[model samples]
Target: MSRYAETYASWRADPVGFWQQAAEQIDWFTPAKSVFNPASGVYGRWFDGATCNTCYNCVDRHVVAGNGDRLAVVYDSPVTGQVARYTFGELQDQVSALASVLRGLGVTKGDRVVIYMPMVPEAIFAMLACARLGAIHSVVFGGFAPQELATRIDDAAPKVVISASCGIEPGRVIAYKPLLDEAIDLSENKPDHCVILQRDTQLCDLTPVRDVDYAEAVETALARGEGTECVPVDATDPLYILYTSGTTGQPKGVVRDNGGHMVALKWTMEHHYDIKPGEVFWAASDVGWVVGHSWICYGPLLHGAATVVFEGKPVGTPDAGTFWRVIQDHGVAALFAAPTALRAIKKEDPKGTLIGEYDFSKFRTLFLAGERSDPATIEWAQEKLDRPVIDHWWQTETGWAMSGNPVGLGAFPVKLGSTGKPMPGYDIRVLDDAGNAVAPGTLGNIVCKLPLPPAGFPTLWNAPDRFISSYMAEYPGYYATSDAGIIDEDGYVFIMARTDDIINVAGHRLSTGAMEEVIGSHPDIAECAVVGKADALKGQMPLGLFVTNNGANRDESELERELVQLIRAKIGAVAAFKHAIEVKRLPKTRSGKVLRGTVQKIADGESFKMPAAIDDPAILDEISAALKAHNMIGEPV
Candidate 1:
């Protein structure tokens, strides 16, 4: 047996002890006396009694260990055609200077500081600066609507807002300062100050009384010759508050603590990603999302690795070869991206010509997350790259991968469609409505047995009752994931779909994810999403919307028939998957999760509002037209 197997078994036997040992790896200002405290009536706390500064662990310690000269971050932007690298020492100094600036702005420990910047080095600097001062940083994804930004501002009520003047997109520049100004104008609770990075002075507005230039702040701090001290914070102090889309249409702020998050991410960087210190790690995600928070910014830094901050898409910024070019140029050992990204790249280059043009000898592994990974996308990628394309499952609530193939530990057996076994700290189960564990091969709700592992969201920011009712109340002693999946006899877990995403045909429940997986596997199809439409006799039926590969020559009607037949053959007739339509593109969020619910609502002619996180708002019109043309639903008069 592999040593990873031993480690898993030992962790299963003693989870608390395993995590306690893991926590010892970090240099804490004051060591923790207790590993976990759960009986506090609220959410459980981890690493209790510890005092540490997160910035010190991520930046200062690496510099002190003689790795200061090693590159800590590489900022690559295809939009601007610029490449910049920062060493550990340089990053620490920048973070320190910014920390001093925040202190000068009256930001003290526990104060909320909102970051509204693009995918730039300054964003990381702002995050670390907040950590250095023990202030909670809430980073909103750049380019969100003014109302959405205002809502976040009203919630966090930060004393300072840090942002750039503009953001660089594929063929355009987004003026972020205007949006920030408009948001603050619309907000009921205005921030006391605004710090703007003047990426474009021509497009920016400075409020003399309330705003300060980032360059001027840094220069002043440097001139003062003051070393900003890293304030020691309690182990359970809130590090950041990230808002994720909630079921009720209100965004819920997920809070991550300092010590537990640091410990868990460091462990994941080594155990899950299999990259050690000094190796390059690239997570192709935006900083607004949890993946970006955990992997892109903090995780790699905590593990002493160089993280690449990419400001480009998987395709069309330069071309379909963007990811390949980055991998080859940066020597990225492990790459994490959404499945939607791979699907888009595969659609544009079905023959993998783009991949063939690059030399990826340094690339070791490929991981997929954020959204569900279809077996077709995973197989094509793994075969094309000649490496393992691992698919893992976790949530924004959980900071890291809860179930994933540990590539560094050993070559675990690959189950193509399965996300892999639960990680060492997670005890996952598929439970029925009554909270009983379901038998193997039976679909049920996915839940994690309490107390949740370290690095997990302890509670919603300022809303402990919402946290309990949202996650814990559904299952008395478990964290209800609200996702539906099944566990195989061999313990491999397969996430079928979200619980609410299940389609009911007559009395049989069908998984849209399962149908999409089979449809997407068809050689002609590049990607697909399935939603349920109302049927006269069956009550509801599966409707698959798909994008074809570039070289597919079949007509839309013929391709639709072929996809329907393929689903019928693979998933059986009980799925009632009759309709498949060829669409130009499926609507997706900025993070690349397909908007299946929006598609379903349109098909059913139900009232539904488009989520604010949608990347392309006009895509909804295309979907509505597709539905009407196919007679799946009639056009609104």
Candidate 2:
């Protein structure tokens, strides 16, 4: 018999068995023969024999059963102040038509496509259609620059690229077609077919440059004879390629297969979220990164639930009240977004204070990820929103939710900082130097234990060695999450950042080592150190301290421009210099591990921690001198 574990006593008994049972929640097209595969290259498979089309379950199941005619998506646009709703059947038809359009563009099974659009209903439909047809879709965030978009296109090498005319918000209109054109121009691996969805223009005058109208394609598909059999995708078939923010070198290409992905995502929804049919589920991820791939697309869709895809920023024209208004207005049951957005809204709360005006009675669980949520942020949101803001701690590599405040199965007491207990069957542990389990209260590296869960990458799209080195090689047998964590005495897990060496810049994962390498590659530079500075907007931004060998020859302003251009050429515009200082000496220990925290402290105009390995304290003066020269000292955090 199944059981619930809302507290420690109930949850500590056994977790793997709970997860094993939860896998049965989704209506599998076929049964899985094996629960786990010990192999390293391929991601672990959940339902080995399962064969279900994700769209069929998300759409056809509910519609054919005649249980849903209610609003599926309540799209609230910030610019026009518009609210549009779509029925479950309407979404199903849209998905089917979109799938037909994709087929028409020669996107067969196993083909890769890029869907670069805003958080709109059509984008969701395109993603569902891809899943239905077994075509892997890589959705890049619309705000990403051309260089960043081009890098993703090069990595994925998609056959088709989809974009919209323009999207509106409080600040500005994101001209999608123009950006897409720029990205496509930069990329040698350009998609043969470019489909444009003209959203802002009622009568869109699409530049006649091999552009297929999105609505026309959908209309054509809607008129097509229904396909007899849905695409029979196996458990191991590659479903999508969700590229992480390339903070280190190139972005690590995390490929999710059909069976294990659906299994893990569906399992996450069932156990961690308790999503049910006919419920309105809304995850505010833009469907670009893993959060969107799993929750926004796979999870709700696989469960035959109505998912919401909103196309506006949280802080729209009216102020920061947009998110709360949408929640109350739509009766959204489940909500998810990054902590960055929450912090912004917290600072810029709408006029006439005390954020208790809206009714959040309908909204049950609130999910947060992308970056860690602080105690103040969580408390503020809960107080204002009047609901439990469940802080979920997982990454792109983990595939689905690993350590989170799971819904019902294990509703453990909310620890101030903990990301709650690991979802059932996650096989998680905090290990010490020797990879042995640490004491409950001791802080150590987090690792996924034996019989690996099926969420992490099954394999890199074309680079298998890259996949192996990224996850396995660093820690040997156990999968290294690169996150510092602690499994507290209370049995809850708390995660810190990626070993303190890396910075979570906005949504991008960046490494101090990688940034230093890029900066050091220049001939004029003697040595360079990159440190992460605390920023409310972009979780953290890289502040570079460069020691130029020929510092006397060039002006600081000229060098700054040169360094920025060099970084842009080397690491693309996304990782370009936020700020740089031409320093005389870098605060490094004799044993060499540049004291980034010390640099960060210096950046924040605070005291520093002297590493025992540092040979000379006098170098600090040089760093201070550099900061003064570059005007970085006394910078607001």
Candidate 3:
């Protein structure tokens, strides 16, 4: 067997040993006596009998190992035009002081602390502080609608809420304090204490009874030389709760364990990204999302790498060159961003001219995730950047990458549309409707074999039954990913779409992702999203919504016909993808995922609630207008 195959075989032979060895990479207050216990359901209990402190592993260990002067975090904000750097010693000091402040407010082990803040350095400080005090934190994305924040608050019922005065977006300053107060008032469960970071004192309001100034608390604690000792907890202790969208459209609080998270993320840094100690690692995502929690916050820090906290949008925060500028200025080695961001850059600078203006010599690799990446975008990025542009796939339920091109483990030939082979720790397979394994090159459900890897979420907070019904009940002895995919003969898996996105047309299942890929590759198109619209003859037909390249002055009718013809030629005439509409833009989430479900609803003339996570709710109006112009629907009811 080859080296990669041999290693994988050894891991399969002894899964427990594989995890035990991986856990040794991090510091443990008490080593694990049992690697895993299968009696625990779903993901099982990993590293049972272990005791550790995540903050100490991330911060204190580096400082104590004589690497105190090494830079730990580099904060770059285009909105504020400020750059701040922190070393291990300084970060640890700040984190410790914040932990002390939380303790002063009567927060103890297992208490939930709600962190609703912007993508600022203090957000990291608050997260690490909670970890230090063994307090479980639920970080709601900043600028969420008051109702949405209230829903999360009611679910978590945190004792303390940490927030900032305002958050800076591309063209506006979003006042967060007012939103926080409104959410608190709307919530049925109220937090007893509120720690407000006075980011803009003029724009902030304080409640006399519950409010505490962050600067005052931290400064006082530091002046008194107050220090918080990292609290050691059991391996299965709840670390933090992250809310992810569920099938019912309500947020499901995914619970993660302390030991498993620390070990798994450290493994990801070296094994997945090939990042070494003190290397600059940047995942340009918000801290409110899982990508931020893993790569941006925990993964890089656990590996002793310098993590960049980017406080800017993908485009128009200055220009499309913002990312490249940060990379050049900070010597960023590995950068992770969504494909949508790349598409935006491609649209803004069609010739890849801005990349030439910046020095990207230090950059090694660019990783894309959060959505399915098109081959055209990958080809464009690779040709322009002259670096490996890898598409890795994972979800919020899984803390790190489940499948990717692990260059550190072994370099493999690039597959244009595939997310490479499954990572070492995960055992993946494709299954048919009846839970039987499917043949290669056949589209079916994606399922992970029993006993998911350590980083897989343990359970949903206060809703174990929902977790089982959602992921486990579908397939016996396997965790259904709720996504559809196909395994090629070479073992590379191509993710087609979500199971719900599979449209059955006259007894034949078709993937919207597959159709979108072909349509998006057209020369005039910048990006496109495909959804199944109801049809009388065919069960469902593919409805394509696309945007043209920025400044591409093309005849809409001519380009639409050409794209439809291209799709028919590439995917065969049975695709029946005749309907293609040109729109000014596509509606997307703040995290850069195209809101396909919403678009489909709008196209079908169905009533769809405007999602609070939408980056621009006004885009839905454009989608409605396009649908009306096409005579596809009467109006968006």
Candidate 4:
């Protein structure tokens, strides 16, 4: 039997005592006066009155404990054909020198530094260097449009911006310097200095007074023996601000504190991921995302494990076998990625032929997040790799998994459609429109009881009232997750869809995610998305868009009919799932989440802003054309 029940019960029994024990794992300069203070921030604060340095806990303490020679980071970029490794000691030297450079440029405690660069090792060094000086770092996605980047720059008001000349892709090079320059020009808040890393692949001209060469500055600091040490800071101090899109035009800046952030992420490395010191843990995500911040950079280093900084696509980085090659090249113990990635690989190599090309001696677990992992994709990965395909659920606000299988405590039996049970510290509840608890297997809003566990956001940057209105005001005492889900009698949580994705079809609420699951299971379909379309007769109807596998050739009309029949048979007649369309590909964000809302807007003939995070704007045209061809476009309001 899994020890998960006992561990969760222990946390629920003594919430403070549980987190206090977890906090002891980190090296703290000053112990906390209280494990929690319910009267602290917007909701509450964890580890109040403690003093700590996140960089030290993540880097220095390990070296001081005589594990300096252990591997700390492995940089593997298939796009550039580059591979580099760094030991804990070497990583410390690089971070210390960079910190000295930032200190010389007048970046002090509480100051914000903006990192706008590609997936180079220097980006990781820049983040750690800022932490070493007790400064907050905000890393924007490398190739964000100038307007989007300008919005973040105006909000964060960073003192120094560290960026690179360009970012290399499979068939092209994206010049980042021009984008960074345009964003600065567009924003009102101007950074004092801009440090640019000049890559040999493509270099750009830099402004004389404002721009500084990254290599020259760091080399000068290193040669002059001007390395800096970690600065002690309060546990409640903000470590970083990650911005997510908001309902309003402005983005919501999510603040993560230093103390609780370290304590919680460190605990997750050992427990949720089952990663140990000196082992390799790869989170195949960009540094701009929360997954990259939590796993690729801080989590593994804090746990004294090696992390892989991969800069390549799941496919087309030479071929579909790239991910397997990286895992085999480095002895990866656990791999975390989004479901979109696996689907992309499965689309190109439908038979799992590429998976057999690599050795799996050191590989163990495969974790999926960022989006709902359809049962079809999960079963394919499990059967091919012969390993546990675990799907955990969380959001950017939480900064860690709220519900997952704790591999260290002993993983529970796999449930294909469920995202496992709630992990320790999360008191999950399914509530109805009346704010009352729902019965087992009943679909309703998912929420967690107040005083959310550590690592969760304390408050939004400069917007405490918005934080309350956005998340807490909905349920009075509980934090609203804004997701529609159900907890079965067996206590397995099934995340059906986002609350907005639930539609009323002649008074019956139906989940688009459920429809997608059934449609995705068809052998000819590689991936699919379902959205509720406006209907005059029925309030709304379910519309499906899907892409076929590599060699699957069937009449589009026949495939559409088959998919509609499949959904009707599985979900009953209330679904109103008659329409289906085959597309070249579905539009997605850079992080692999389908842009369903955008597709819905197109189907309704409504004007929508071009999504800033969309991977390709051209895909929207294709979707619009398909809708027009099918006469599915709704009358514009």
Which candidate number would show the highest lDDT if scored against the true structure?
Answer: 4
Highest TM-score scorer: 4
**Each model's total of backbone clashes:** 0, 3, 0, 0
After superposing candidate 2 on the true structure, give the runs of residues whose Cα lies further than 4 Å from its correct spot.
1-20, 39-44, 201-209, 223-229, 350-354, 433-437, 502-637
Cα TM-score per model: 0.98, 0.76, 0.98, 0.99
As a TM-score, model 2 comes out at 0.76
- What is the clash tally of candidate 4? 0
User: lDDT tens string, model 2, 302-395?
Assistant: 7766677666665545777777777777777888887656655654652215356777777888888766555656766777676778887777
Query: How well does candidate 3 score on lDDT at residue 425?
Result: 76
2 against 4, candidate with superior lDDT? 4
TM-score, candidate 4, is: 0.99
C-alpha lDDT of residue 439 in model 4:
97
Q: For residues 1-637, could you state the per-residue lDDT of candidate 4 as single tens digits?
A: 7899999999989999999999989999999998899889877899999999999998999999999999999999998899999999989999999999888888999999999989999999999999999999999989989999999999999999999999988898999999999999999999999999999999989998999999999999888988998999999999999988532388899999999999999999999999989999999999999998999889999999999999999999989999999999999999999999999999999899999999889999999999989999999999999999999999989999989888988899989889999988899999998899999999999999988888899988888898999899999999999999999999899999999999889999888999999999999999999998888888888889999999999899999999989988999988988889999999998899999999999998888998888888999999999989999898421
lDDT of each: 0.89, 0.69, 0.89, 0.92
Model 4 off-target regions past 4 Å? Answer: 246-248, 635-637
- Worst lDDT 10-window in candidate 4: 243-252
**Model 1 CA deviation exceeding 4 Å by range:** 41-43, 246-248, 634-637
Q: 191-263, model 3: which lDDT tens digit per residue?
A: 9999999885235878997999999999999999997999999879989999984313778999989998888
